[model samples]
Target: MLSKHFRWNKSRVELLGMIILSLFKIQNVQIPKIAEGIISDAKQDSVIKRIYRFFKDQLIDAVEVAALVVDILSLDKYLLVIDRTNWEFGKQSIISSDFI
Candidate 1:
């Protein structure tokens, strides 16, 4: 029967949609532009290739938060940061460090 020859397929529009969705997952736009540039020239790369580029294009949180939470999650000792003045500042780094 003709039904035996039927095959499902995703159109180019669908492929582009999926790829675009991957771009939105990054909280910013710059990385998406870079990812788009990397794969722009490909005429017919595999879906796996697109996914590889997509994941490879991720932005990681470089500031390692020395948290009581994450350490406890890992079952490590909870760090205690005590101040003599009982004053607390954010344990986060400034954006200038990200420039390099």
Candidate 2:
């Protein structure tokens, strides 16, 4: 699915697969935690560096990704809600929304 939208070599494609699996396994988006969940022969630090490099080097198009996801889901019809409200949480401002 990813390859269909992104022009990535074999190693890069495999790294993305590993990162995605790690995200599901660890339930976290933090690079360090995701690295910990990745099943790799390389050292944890190496995995972390690789992940960081991937994000830094990759030119991912959000529109293409969104199209790929919509294609994968095959949703016949759905409502998309985007909340523009700004809420303060401590020192950070967060805007959350849901799709139904």
Candidate 3:
């Protein structure tokens, strides 16, 4: 699929390498591990020769779309933070967020 869209040499590395690079930036993680994880996920797909190449482009596109949306919104100028002195949580699922 990629070969028809891109030159053979670059396209060959596009699926895995590109995805790791893209995911690294957005997720702030390592490359080799990311690539390995991706490979494991795609191990069952016999037709998709390179799982790395497939995810690499998709991850990059997703981040690019997010950045585009932020640009379109341009909400930084109007940003504000409001604090509440009293707060309570009841009967709700709790999810931990590390990145604020």
Candidate 4:
């Protein structure tokens, strides 16, 4: 169901799989860590650079991806829930840029 967004190539699908696997495995999402998880015999530095380049070159449409997910689930009438909240860690400054 989520395969239509990718290009017609194995590398794109492979990268997507790598990203999904890394997301499930790691709690903290780090680019270098995800790159290292890719199943290739290449050097660590090379893999890291390739990952960085892939993200830098590709334009991932986040909104479209989200829409696709919602559409897929809507067919089955699955409940979709989203929760959002904003909280400050400490006292707010009077001259803070976040005020605007």
Query: Could you say which candidate leads in TM-score?
Result: 2
Better of 3 and 4 by lDDT: 4
* CA shift of 23, model 3, Å: 2.8
List candidate 2 segments past 4 Å from native. Answer: 85-100
Backbone clashes in model 3: 6
Give the CA lDDT, 0 to 100, for residue 30 in model 4.
Answer: 87
Question: Local distance difference test, per candidate?
Answer: 0.43, 0.84, 0.47, 0.68
TM-score of 1: 0.21
lDDT per residue (tens digit) for residues 29-82 in model 2: 999999999998999999999999999998878787777778789888867765
Give the candidate order by descending lDDT.
2, 4, 3, 1
Over 1-100, each residue of candidate 1 has an lDDT whose tens digit, in order, gives: 1112212234433444455555666434454343453344554344456655545664323233234236437655556663434332586444333343
| 10 residues in a row with least lDDT, candidate 1 | 1-10
Could you tell me which residue pairs clash in candidate 2? Answer: none
Regions of candidate 1 where Cα sits further than 4 Å from its true position: 1-10, 27-46, 50-100
Model 2: C-alpha RMSD to truth? 4.7
Superposed by TM-score, candidate 1 places the C-alpha of residue 96 at a distance from the truth, in angstroms, of 36
Which predicted model would earn the best lDDT? 2
Would you estimate the TM-scores of all the predictions?
0.21, 0.74, 0.22, 0.60
In model 3, which runs have C-alpha deviations exceeding 4 angstroms? 9-26, 40-100
Q: What would the per-residue lDDT of candidate 3 be over residues 14-94, giving only the tens digit for each residue?
A: 554555455665474544444444434354343234543454554344444445556667667645454533333685434
- Candidate 4, residues 1-100: lDDT per residue as tens digits? 3456555267766777777777677644788888766778888788778778778887778676776777766765656564433445577543445533
